[model samples]
Target: MAYVITKLCLNCKDIACTQVCPVDCIYEYKGDDPSIPKEMLLIDPDECIDCNACVPECPWEAIFEESEVPDIFKDDIELNARIVGKERFVPKRNPDDPIPTPEQIAANKEKWGYKP
Candidate 1:
């Protein structure tokens, strides 16, 4: 099975995991406006190679194997697939790109009302 991105990534949006994915299956939902901050990143199940390379790269520990996804966040599997199906997925930023700064993360957390 493929990996899944859970709600823990909502505001954190850390791209380290994306950088390590060999298949470039990781994507961020840009919504309708590219200028707006993305709500979360997603792993395209169809494209993922089950490499598990992205598991440890997440600073927020949001990635999990599809079958191992925690019950609380189990719905993320369907969310990921639905978003991908809607063509809302976009390739991750360049691996050499920098991740969000602490300030940015904090702002996003506030904007999204993310408790974690």
Candidate 2:
């Protein structure tokens, strides 16, 4: 099964996962919603090789195996699948950016109303 990028990534699109993705299945969703603090990044489940390459790369702990996706973020499964053909999106993950520290990641998740 494909790995899913969840709400923990709402304000943190570090792109670390994309940097190591062998197939580049990750995408950047361009939504005009004013509440989104940053550009949203999603994994194209259909294209994901299920190689587990993107899982450890996400500092926000945003990516999870499709079956392991927590219930709080469960809606994202359909969200990821449905957005593919219906929204404005692009393959925009390409930079060797610095990975976030544990503290930074925790803070980001908190900003998005998540704590763990």
State TM-scores per candidate: 0.70, 0.75
Q: What CA root-mean-square deviation does each model show from the true structure?
A: 5.0, 3.3
- Distance from true position, residue 81, model 1, in Å? 0.7
lDDT of every model, 2 decimals? 0.73, 0.73
- lDDT per residue for candidate 1 within 1-116, as digits (tens), equals 88998877875674678778887788876657543236788888888899888997876667889998877777888877755554455555555656666676566545544555
Candidate 2 residue lDDT tens string, 27-81: 7756665432235577778888899988877777898899998877888787676
What RMSD does model 2 have?
3.3
